[model samples]
Target: MSNEEKQAPQDQVEDVIESEVAQEDAALVDELTQANFRIEELEQALAEAEAKAAEEKDAALRAVAEMENIRRRAAIDVEKSRKFALEKFANELLPVIDNMERALLGTVEDEAAKAVIEGVELTLKTLMTAVAKFGITPVDPMGEAFNPEHHQAIGMQPSTEYPANTVMLVMQKGYLLNDRLLRPAMVMVSQG
Candidate 1:
């Protein structure tokens, strides 16, 4: 073959190689771009999944804390219920206790024995202490203003010794549990 012909063939081969290399480079660039896009998509999905997981964890923690608080409150409620179970019964017994106290303190016109009086007084004081520990208290509104909420005006007495609408005498003492009235004070209010 001639020299020019050989050079022509060599140049054609170089051109073919360059074209093939360009095609390969283009394919590689497209693959790299596709891979980058896929990576970005995967990263977004991962971030979303992580965020969702964090939110779920926080929700679960809050729910658990709420349940714990409820359990603690329930326990406290049960304890309070047990402690105050006698509240109603004690309320009912307040009148009896007051009657006992009144009977013991009244002028013994009858020939009552000294030993009997001492025994009765001691019993009353003891009972009063026990009920007092359970939040029961006596309301002896003697000389205090007669409050309609705590006092019952059974009789009106005209007296210059006391102000009007004042409790002259507590006929039967009242009792209270906490702030609740077990029995209202039976009182005689002075009208004068």
Candidate 2:
């Protein structure tokens, strides 16, 4: 009931209020710290996701480039196949052409035989034209420099008109299918 007694009780109440406020401030600081840590963790996870996405993008681009290269190569292969489709057939017909050439080289003095020869000559010309249309070309090395790639020398002989190592006579004409040699020309070379 006195003044001192009243003052003591009021001080005790103030101290209790200060203690509660301090406890609340400490809890708020702890919550803020936890939130900040969670934000940092989220940022790290986002960075990792971005890196993975970049790697996947690079891999996809590389795969697309590889596919394009394969497509280009396949297109080239198909074009080559289209150009050389009749290679085997042309190669098989070479022996028939050689025999026809040999038959044409023989002379016929009789009138009836001359007509037959003319017919055979015309047939050979027609066959040659057909083969040429399919990119089959003749390799006639007669009177030119002999090359091992296109010409096969059966024998060498001394020649007066040609230089040494030159093709003197073509024994059997070879054929080429589009720049590639189907058969080598059999030839006689001039001796060095």
Candidate 3:
């Protein structure tokens, strides 16, 4: 009816609309905050999962490296076994060779004995040749400098011919299998 009365009702309607808009804006802000929190939680979970995966991967790599090392060691062990398989057999055969050498040294110079000596000599030569083919080398340290690693000093002798600390006489011959000493040469060393 009057201008003041009409303006008052219009202002009331505008206030109601403004109040609804404010409530809606507050609801939207709350929802956006919740969504950002959920994203942060998911990011943290993803980071944790990635870190766990990385740790597992590192463990797997270490396991693989260890397996490879084991395989390499096994291969080396197999090769060594193959190289020294006949070590025990070679050791057992050494006494036979020593006896044969002793027999040859003790033979008398008879006409009939000479034929038997020749036969024994041929047999000994054949046996030595066969053993030499299998990486079995003789360690005959005759008149060489005494080495404790290869030669064992049984007794020291005063010698004018050899220098001091030299191998004067090899008592029993030593043998080597693949450059590894099977037995040390029993020798008499010159006194220093």
Candidate 4:
């Protein structure tokens, strides 16, 4: 109950309170460090996600561009097909034109035959004009140099009127449709 006894009790109480406050400060520091580490981890994860999203977006754009190019190429091919669609029909009609020409070249001894020949001549000319307008052109190789691409040599004959390897006679005329060979001219070439 003296001064020293009273001072001892007061000092004990202050030391207990200081220890508790120090423990609380240590716990708060630990929590703050943990929070900072978590923030860094979240920042790294966000950066990775953003980079992945950018890569996916770029891939999608490239795919769209490639598809557009393919569509454009397909449209061009379709247009070219449409332009050449009449090639087969024109080729089939070439024989009919040849027959008409042969009929017109026949001798007309009687007046009735002459009139019929004249009518055939007119028809052949009209058909030729019609075919020409549709990009159909005749390949008459007679007296021209033989070309393997445009002329098919059926026979070889000795000829003094023209040079060797020249087209002496075109057995059947060929045809072209829009600069493309529909058929090669069947011809007899002069032997070298």
Whole-model lDDT, candidate 1?
A: 0.88
- The sequence of per-residue lDDT tens digits that candidate 3 reaches over residues 55-174 is 999999999999999999999999899889989999999999988888898858799999998889999999999999998989999999998989999999898889999999999999
Runs in model 1 deviating more than 4 A are: 1-7, 109-115, 141-172, 178-192
Whichever of 3 and 4 has more TM-score, that candidate is 3
List, residue by residue over 1-192, the lDDT tens digit for candidate 1: 999999998999999999999999999999999999999999999999999999999999999999999999999999778767778899778767877776677555445565677788888889989888888888999999989989999999999999999999988888777667768899999997
Clashing pairs for model 4 are none
Ranking by lDDT: 3, 2, 4, 1
The candidate scoring highest on TM-score is: 3
**RMSD (Å) per prediction:** 4.0, 3.5, 2.4, 4.7
Comparing 1 and 4 on lDDT, the stronger one: 4
Please write out the lDDT profile of model 2 over residues 157-190, one tens digit for every residue: 9978889999999889989999889999999999
Summarize candidate 4's per-residue lDDT along 1-192 as a digit string, tens digits: 999999898988988888899999999999999999999999999999999999999999999999999999999989879879998899789889989978876686999888889899899999999999989999998999999999999999998888999999988899888888999999999987
If both were scored by TM-score, which would come out higher, candidate 1 or candidate 3?
3
Model 4: per-residue Cα lDDT at residue 151: 94
Q: Give the TM-score of candidate 1.
A: 0.71
